[model samples]
Target: MSESVAGREAGSGIPARRLWLATTLILLIFVLLLAAYLLLRKPTEVTVPAPVAAVPAPDPAFATRVRQLEELNRSLEAEIARLGRDPSPLACPPGTARRAEARPPQTPAIA
Candidate 1:
């Protein structure tokens, strides 16, 4: 009975030893290909830009304009600081009350 079973297994399917050998061979080929690719690949190269020549001097007019703009900016900042310190509402100036008193009174609106 054991002989019959062994014979049946042999005829019916591939042997375990043959399957293992075939799997090992395929894996070895893959590993060898990976190793070859790694060894034969070209190294990456980095290129740097050339240094620029001496920069040209800035335009005199541009320097003057920059100075003017800086002065304007400082004046604006000072104005902003002064306004920030004033507690009065911007909608009404200090002389608005005298103007309102001089104007004739208007009749109340009917609801």
Candidate 2:
């Protein structure tokens, strides 16, 4: 096997290792040139305006709901004041599970 391997060399005194080194250097040079070209290319930059702040108007339905709530609140206060005279009968939201005297927790109990 050694005798056959000896003839594998060109006998130019240059080793097979030198061929591998030359191939590596050639590839390295090509990579460097590609990287240099990419680095030197012009780059673009963009500027965008900051968004303006604006006051938001209440939604139509929301405004209507607010008015309805105010009316309902006033009516409720009046009813309470009227009912304040007689403590016997009570009023409650329709479909409430319990009796009117059994007032549901409006402001949650402080823990």
- In model 2, residue pairs whose N, Cα or C atoms come closer than 3 Å (at least 3 residues apart or on different chains), thus clashing, are none
Q: What C-alpha lDDT, on a 0 to 100 scale, does residue 74 get in candidate 1?
A: 100
What does candidate 1 score on TM?
0.45
- The Cα RMSD of model 1 versus the native structure comes to 8.6
* Best candidate (score: TM-score): 1
Clashes of 1: 0
RMSD per candidate (Å) reads 8.6, 13.6
Error of 2 at 94 (Å): 42
Error of 1 at 49 (Å): 4.3
List model 2 lDDT by residue over 1-111, tens digit each.
887678665564476678989999999999999999899988888899999999798799999999999999999999999888876555555676685589666986798
For all predicted structures, in order, the TM-scores are 0.45, 0.34
**Reference-based lDDT, each prediction:** 0.88, 0.84
